[model samples]
Target: MNPAREENPTLLDGFRDGYSVHLDKFDGPLDLLLHLIRKNEVDICDIPIADITRQYLDYIKLMKVLNLDVAGDFLLMASTLLHIKSRMLLPPDDEEESEEEEGDPRAELVRRLLEYQQYKEAGMVIGARALLGREVFTRACPDPALSAARTEEGPLEVSLFELVDAFRALLARIPKESFHDVAPGDSLNIADCINEILSLLQDRDTLQFDELIKDELTSERVIVTFLALLELCRLKLIRIFQNGEYGAIWFIPAVAPEQAGSAGEAVQSPV
Candidate 1:
C-alpha cells in the first residue's frame, strides 16, 4: 500500500488533500477504470494488476463513504479483477505444458477496456458535433415561406423525438402491395415530401386541414408529410395555427424574407 493512499483513505479523498480531482463524472465501471488507468499513466495493454486493484478498491470504498448507489455490474467487475489477480499469484498448473499455453488472465479485460475507450471517444466526438450544430448560424438565402411575426421569433427548433414521430407516421401511410411480381413504381419518399410541402407552402401561403390531407395518400405518406412540415417549421419556413381550445390545424408559410430565421410554431389538434 502506498503510504500516501493509506493516509488519504478514500480514492478521491487523496485528491482533496492536495492532488487535483480532474474527472467529475464517469459513465460506468469501464469509464471509471479507464480514468484510473489514465491518471496513473499505466499502459492499458499490460495493466499492473496489484496497483490497479488497490486503486479500484479505494474508489469503491469512496463510493461507500459518499453513500453512492453501488450497482451490481460494478461489483461484478471488481470481483472479476480480484479473481484475475488471485489467479496471477498461483503457480502454473502442472498439467499446463508451457506459459504460452496458459493465456494471460487480464487479456480479455484489457481488450474490452480498449474497445470501450474507443467507443467512448467516438461518442464524445459525436456529442461535440451535435453541440456545434445547435449554435445558430445566419443563412445567405432568405426563406419566403415564413410569416413576418414568426420570423421575428428566432429560428425554429425541433427535438429528435418529434422527427421520429413524423417518420413513424410516414411509414404507416405506405400502401401494402401483395403482388409478388409487381413492385410499386412510385411511392412518396421523405425528401420528396419535404420538398413537396415547401413548394405547397410557397404557392398557397396557407393550407387548411382539408387541403393538406389527400384521400389517395397512404398513412405513411401523411406522417412523412407532417414530419416534413415540422421540419420546415423548424427552419422558420412555416407557421401553424388553431382557433380556440380545439380547432382545425392550419399551416401558413412565412412570407417575410427575414422571417426565415424565426422560431418554429406548431398547432396541435385537440384530443
Candidate 2:
C-alpha cells in the first residue's frame, strides 16, 4: 500500500522470487497455470481447483493493485477454474447415476492441458531441428566456369566419397610388399603425382579412373594417384563421374586452359 511503490509498480512488488516478474513473461493462461501447478507439486490431471483458483485470483488481484496490464486470457482461465470448482462442490441431481456414466468436471481442462503440453514439446523439437540445420551449410563450387561447364556437359553423377570408396576397394587388392627392391624412406610427392595425372588427362578427354592406376599396384602409388585426383577436382582441372551408383568412375578433364597454364607456370618456377 506504500504510495511510492504504487508510483512504480511491478508484478514482483510483493512477491519473493529473488528476481522481478512480469505478466509478459508468461506465454499465456495455460503457461501460467502450469507454472502454478508445478509450484504446488499437484498433478495436472487431478488439479486442486480450490487451491489453484485461490492462487490464481491472488495473482490477478496483485496485478490489478499494481496496475499491471492483465490480458483477457488470464481472466478467462480464472473463470473456468472457478466454474469447475463450483461444479465439484454441488451434488448430482440423480443419485441413481453410476460413477462410470458420470462425467468428471476436470475432463475438459485435463484434455486442454495434455494437448498444450504435447504441442509445446513438438515446438521444442522443431526448434531444435532448425538449430541443427543452421550448423550445417553447403557452399557453391568455387569455380563458376567449371560448374557451368559441368552443368552444360552433364552433372557429375558420383560424389567424392563414392569415388574414394572405389579407389579404396581397388587398393585392397594390391599386395603390401613392392615387386622391386625396397627403399627405406621413399615416398611419392603429391606435386609429381598431380603433374603425371594432368599429362595423362591432356592426351585424352576422358579416362577410366581404375585404368589410370591399373599399371601401378603398389599402395603408395595408388594413394598418390587418389590424392592427385582429389587435388585436380579441387582445382577444377578434372571432374569424376559415373553413369549409375556403384558404377565404374570416369575422370573427365575440365577444359580450363588459362587455369591449367597458370598452375603449370607456378610449378615450373624456380623454388
Candidate 3:
C-alpha cells in the first residue's frame, strides 16, 4: 500500500489498492468517451463536443498528475476530438460544401460507440451465463461431514481475475532474457498440462499456485499450464481457494468418494 493512500479508504479498498491500470481501467479512448457520455446522460448520437472533450481532457490531465502512463491511443483520440471541434467552427462555402466538408462531425464516432456498446453488453450477458453455469451444483441427501466442510471453507470458487493476476505477478519475477527451448513446434498443449495437474493431485490433495507452473520455464508452458488450471476448475475437477485476503491460492482436487462412485455408475449404465 502506498503511504499517500493510507488516509483514503476508498482508494485502498477499490480495485487492488487502487492500483492504476491501463487508461485508468477504461478499455480505450472510445471506452472513456462512452463513460463520459453515459455519466453526463448525454445522447450518444448528439454528443456535445465541447463539453465531452473538456471532460475527456480533464481525465487525461488527472492521469498525468497521478503519474499514470497515457497510451498513444488516448492522445490520438484527443487530437481527433480537437479536429472535429475545429471543423465545426469553420464557415461553409455552400450548401453542397457544408454537406461534404462537415456533415455531422461526430457521425463516425457515434457509430463506433454504438457498435462497441452492443458488443460490451453482449459480453456481459455471456459472462453472466458463465457465472450461472459455474454455480450449478447437484443436490444430494444432506451429510453432516460435507456440511461441516462447507461451513469451514466459505467458498471453493475464486474469481478468474485473481488467477490471472497471480499468474502475471509470478511471470514478472522470471528473467526477461531467460533461455528456453521454445522451437517452432514445441508448444505444450492444454490437454497434456491437464493430465500433469491430475498426476500431481494424485499424491497430494492440494498444490500451491506457483508449484504447478514452477517447472514451466518457458512462456508457452506457463500459459498452457494456466489455461489447464482454468479448464480443470471449469470442469469441477479442482477447487481454488485462499486462506486470507491476498493469500496464496491452492488448487485442490475436487473429487470425493461420492462423486467418484456416481461417475462410475453413470459410465457403467446404458447411454
User: What are the lDDT scores of the predictions, listed in order?
Assistant: 0.63, 0.72, 0.72
The CA-based lDDT of model 1 is what? Answer: 0.63
Q: Tell me the RMSD of model 3 versus the true structure.
A: 14.9
| Per-residue accuracy of model 2 over 49-151 as CA lDDT, tens digit each | 9888877776777677668788999999999998999888888546544635356788898889888888887888987773322554336644443444355
What's the lDDT for residue 170 in model 2?
83
TM-scores of the models, in the order given: 0.46, 0.41, 0.42
For model 3, the stretches where C-alpha displacement exceeds 4 angstroms are 1-24, 93-102, 131-133, 136-271
Q: Which numbered prediction scores highest in TM-score against the true structure?
A: 1
Q: Sort every candidate by TM-score, greatest first.
A: 1, 3, 2
Candidate 2 contains a number of clashing pairs equal to: 0
> What is candidate 1's lDDT per residue for 1-271, written digit by digit as tens?
6676665464666565676654346678898889889988989988998888778877776777567777887888899899989978987676673635446889989989999999999998987773322453335323222232233453343344544554465455556652233435557555566555555665665675445556545554466576667666666566666432233456667655234322222222110
Worst lDDT run of 10 residues, candidate 1, spans 262-271
Q: In angstroms, give how far residue 131 of model 2 lies from its true place.
A: 3.2
Tens digits of lDDT, candidate 3, 39-79 = 88999989999888877887776677677789999999999
Model 2, residue 102: what's the lDDT? 54
Question: Given candidate 3, what's the lDDT at residue 37?
Answer: 94
